[model samples]
Target: MMRKIENALAVALIAIVAVLPLFLKFMQGVCRVQVPGADIAVLHFVFLFASVAGLVTWREDRHLSLASLSSVFGEKIRRPIESVKTGGASCILSALFINAFCQLVNPAQFDARFWGMSVRFFFASLPLCYFGIIAMISCKKGNLIASLIGMVFGLFISMGPFTGILYYLFGMENVPSLYAINDAWLSFSKIALLPIIVIFSSLAFFGMPLFLVLGGIAYVLFSAGGGYVDVIPLETYRILTDRNIAAIPLFTIAGYILSQSSAGSRYVAVFKSLIGPFRGGTVIAAVIVSTFFSTFTGVSGITILALGPLLAVVLTGSGYSKDRAESLVTASGAIGLLFPPSAAIIMYATVNYFSIDVFDLFKGAIIPGCIMALSMMATGVVLDKRGERPKFSGKEARDAVLHCIPELLMPAFISVLYFKGVFDLFEAAAFAVIYAFCLSVFVRRDFTLKKSARVVASSVPVSGGVLFILGAASGISYFMLDANVPAILSGFITQYVKNPYVFLILMNLVLLVVGCLMDMFSAILIVSPLLLPLAESFGVSAVRAAVIFLMNLSIGFLTPPVGMDLFISSYTFDKPLSRVVKGILPFLIVQFAVLMLVTYVPFFTEAFL
Candidate 1:
């Protein structure tokens, strides 16, 4: 019952937030609730979210347990409560000590009277911190009163002190609902930024969403800049408005159709029929099929899940060792990442500031992607010396091609639709969904309407989750851009690194570690923004930089200790994680070599661009 409620509330929250932009426009244009210079949209989000929190808080039958809620949040909200306690206390002390040191450095550096101001301000805000911690912890365990408190806190903080009252009381004083930015708040907020970053970063380490940290950073920076808190909501509105943005969900639905259908089998058959007669033929077929199939799913694990057993049989049966076969195929699983219409590239491009033609970006990645794919297969060909080459029959080849035509032509069809100017990306995506629907229902008949419906429904959370993160993270982008974070970051890095080669080398090493730690989606959203300016300073084009960055993270799948595909591969093959790590090491080394080459030789990507 609680699970049902949480799902319902989460779905409602996403559905409502998805359409909030239109609602905001209506309030401003038709209802006229917006003040001339103030943002009523932010207030609306505050209220709407509070309302959702209320719904999540409600117990229809007096059933209560926050465990369901915690599971619903997974790791995303788990650490915020505890971290806020320890981190908040540390923040207060650090500010006190730092302020004292600064006071000694030069009494005239700042207002000498304001030496211990940050520490004093922290004490004042300690109650709010306690309120937040209790609210989060209580929400985690499903406390009705705590959820209500959270709702109240949301309303109060969003409205601050000014906008909640004074609407009809004294309405005529130059945008009277306007909550003026307090300067003392600004100075103290700026002082608070360091501790805020450290605390949030700590939460992030515990698996909290980076967006929360980013949002906190945005709030403080916006406060310091005298900007409205509404910018976060407003940027979210802007992200949703982009035409390319709608393509994400459409393609996601389309991908699920193929992944859930017989497309994987058909793809494997086609490759086998065509290439099963050569030396190292099975290895080639496995690489090609896995690469092509994973593009639709945008998940490396799906390759292992759907085709791991078949590929394993083919490779081991072809005289390859079990560990070698498993390792090689697992490494090849992520080769789809660089292919066109891989959903993630769109996410990267959507949030990016540069102008990237999706097709053009697709064109740029072809060579780099192929290099990684070929390199994985090449390593296999060198290691495995197989003697059996099956004689190919023309009838079987024809049958296989005929069976695979729809799946095989998908990328080319979508590319033509997108690149040839025949349709907008959204239309292309819609057509892809429609095409997949036709294949799944009428031609392939892999699932009935009910099953297909479930497939589409399952994809909603993925789409919704990604969109939520994008929206929340946009606030940080706004704040960082406003705060000159990119400039400051580049300035600081160049001050120490000096050589562009050294910077590039460090970027490769650091990103490999990052990839091993976080999923690609989170890493790209959180890390890419920071890396972009630094890469540009080193004179890398956005396309090349993106390719390099993605490729490294792609290889990060083969890394140990929570690499996304490593766990999946372990489960798929019924191997323990330690064995999985050992099996994957050689292929990982080769991928790192490819990564280094891609990093240094911009020509691989540049040639296609």
Candidate 2:
């Protein structure tokens, strides 16, 4: 039943993304559905909104707590105010679209400022609409009325009726500083910010989806700061629609295609032949294969979700316990982030608000990445000491090598094209898609045209979910930057911690905490900026700083309590979270050891650079 639902969802996402290249032409002014007041009517904006709405609804449960609005949140908020479904999102989206369209057609009174405000209001309401729509669509009649009442209250707040009355009472229209005129409102918003943060923070505490929580807090903070409401959707549209970032989804699809085919097994077979008669050949094979996918795909979860089961079976079949096998696979899952062309690394470079070259960072990652992979391999050898070495056959080795050639050569193919400037990252991604398609469909005969569609269908949602988080996260990032929050935090850190060693330790702890709270991609966006300044104060190179920061985030994915990879491992192996936690401890300890080495040994990152 779940598989059927997932298949249906994948098909829908593919259809939506398929519309992008065609509809994006409209975004560039080559095509548009002209409404009256608005000159730029981007159809792709509507498509993206619909895509985001669907992704949030499909991926998360539809529910909220009334008590979340009050001071009480822990257990009291457990009882959902109401549950929602897809229809709820559609209703709110319909409202947003209709209201936006109506404003574009004929904004009330036609004043230019009012027209702009109306448009800004439409875009600003997007994040809130995620909840507001759900509230309206709850099955209960009371929920419907409550949602409407909340909407009314929101509208009143937006208009500032109280501010207008206070201004009239004070006769402050002629004030030199405009801020002095609306003094009461500004003070109140600032004063109320603490509670406002607390209220929204609970939404995240209760698992209101990180993307929504990030965007929601940004919205609330921006509103309090008297910022342009349009920043919310504008940042959403900008970060998501970047041409370079398109490589993420393409590479993810390629990785998934290889995973779902014979490619993974072939990879393992080739590694087995090379390691011939080793005590832990199979464990090495699983780690190497996982590294290949995680490097290109950029999400450790993909490696586990696609390859963990097969690797688990191979390890257990080779006389390792099931728990041990699961633990090995789980720990090795996130090592891909240490490699070049890492989605996390690229995103860190792109969003860091600095001028760091992608290639330079790629150059710096090699040694540390190797250390991580080797640590896992050594751990595997030590943990399972029983020597049941497979007999090495030259014929079998030759056959395995022959079978793996086409896929194994992928990194070189991508590197020469990318490094030699024959193609950019997105073009390399395009080539990768084409290359993987041929390898699977023709050379390997692992998939035909019909079978390939199933591969694509399964892969599209991963891309959608990832891309959606990036889109929403940008708004959160902008809010922090605009508030000079990073500068303030950096100053605070530098003021207290002068030692680079102490700072690095604190940095690791902070990143680990952040990793447990959000996805690594989102973590890079929000946290990297605050910490990077200390790199200069502590006299570290940009490449080393980035590696230190990203590497910690990589390990954070393995960190317990809410590490994203732990959950992925649990779901993949059908193990309870606690068991996965217990299973991964020794591996986690080894990860920490390597992390300490990478932290102290400047040679590991700087040598290649």
Candidate 3:
């Protein structure tokens, strides 16, 4: 019953938020409420509600339990509540108090001092509160440490100098209604009350929807109340026409479709057959296959997921040690970062206000990619010196090549179309999709209309998730531009390093670090705007800068913690992350060395440009 209510509420809330503007306009026409910027108000409401709904859904789905009053209050004689009903009431009251306090505080003084301090306060307060709550709930809970870690994350989101930088960039005047509360009471009300509403509302299916509706109302009220409001004029839409920008989704879709096709599997088979006979051949096969497929796919997750199993079979069959095989594939999985049609590259290009020929980028990446692959092969050889390398017969090789013919043609077809100007990026992508569909249905005889529809549906989520992030990043970029962040960053870099070469190297290192910590798409969107202009100031070719940025980000997938490729490989091989990292160190070093080469020698990328 609770779940059903939650579901209904969630749906209702989404609908309300989506239609808020139209409703508001109608209300204004019918009776003058004198609402200012109804569209902006509607947007603010939608953003907040969406955020709350997403948070609630995530929490519920994860079964993230909260702590008990006793744990949080340290076994006080006066227990707050035994049931969720009482607990929720207490939360509402507490949030109300916080909100009142925030509202009563002076906006000007808070802006002067607490504005900057709010980020730290949020980090310090929210996590501690959550931890205390969680600790009070269940004694057997093991997530206390995880919650504490999340506090650190909260700090990154809230208190960091970077946060201030971002806030300033996004246009301090244009902060959303919910986020723009100036009075301490209002601020507290928004922060505390909003989260509580989300949690309680999520308790029932309808809760999320209700919360969204309330959030929309709050946005309307806040915006009408008039704190700070600035909306980009529609003229800014012209920036979308930049040729390179169009390549992003095209490349992304191409990569997605290729991964979905049998071509992905056949590519793996060919790599295995060719390299399986050599010493540490399976590892080599993994590296080769990953590298080759990455050219068209450009996604580390898809590449690793698709190729990991195939490589594993070849490696084990070729007499390589299991550890060596696992480590080799894991290391090779990083190739997706360097290949063309890469999300990283597309993202970097989009953010930097430029584009590179995907084919040209592929050519430039070959040397560096080869270096990483060879390094992986060397590591496998060293690790399994005694293992017998499998031998491939002529017949076996012939059959393997023949099996991969359909798959092999995909890259060639894409490259030819792109180079011949047969179609723009989107049109080329459409062609690729059509080609894949034909191959799957006619050649492979494996695809039904229903199956194809499912595949397309599955791909939508993947595409949507990425595009959503892009939109958010764009929003953040808008904010940053308003703040003059690019100018400030450029000034700082120029002051510190006058030499272009030194500056480029420094930028590479920074991007590498950022890539290791953040998702490639988000990182590109966030960092590229500030850094790209700086590169241009130093007379760096836009294409060269983009290539360097892509390479650095690609290397990031091999690093610890946030490395998506490492995570995929670890899961595929069922090996500890630490072991995989250790085994991949040699490959990492070689890749980094290649990155440095690309950074210093402009010719590596610029020759083609």
Top-TM-score structure, candidate number: 2
* Model 1, span 1-609: residue lDDT tens: 754554454445433433444444456668988644122332233233322332332222111111112333546565456434334323322222222222223223222122223222212222232243334445454444434544443333343223322332444335523344334455666677688667656655544444344555656566556635546544654564455665655565577677678886787777777887777777888898788767766667767876788788877877788988888779888898898777667767766647455666677788999999999878877776776677988899999999888887888898886788766565566677777878888888998976776665555544544444565566777676666887898899988998888999899888888877655666676678778889988898888888888898898777777676887788789998799998888888888898888889989888966
Better model by TM-score: candidate 2 vs candidate 3: 2
By TM-score, rank the candidates, best first.
2, 1, 3
Instruction: Give the better candidate number (1 or 3) by TM-score.
Output: 1
Please say which candidate is ahead in lDDT: 1 or 3.
Answer: 1
lDDT (10s digit) by residue, model 3, range 529-609: 878789988998776777677778778877766565776687777777788888777767867877787788777675644
Candidate 2 TM-score, C-alpha based: 0.79
lDDT of each: 0.63, 0.67, 0.53
Tell me the lDDT of candidate 3.
0.53
Ranking by lDDT: 2, 1, 3
Q: Candidate 1, after superposition: displacement of residue 453 in Å?
A: 0.2
Name the best candidate (by lDDT).
2
Model 1 weakest 10-residue run by lDDT: 59-68
Clashing pairs in 2: none
> Which lDDT value does model 1 have at 494?
86
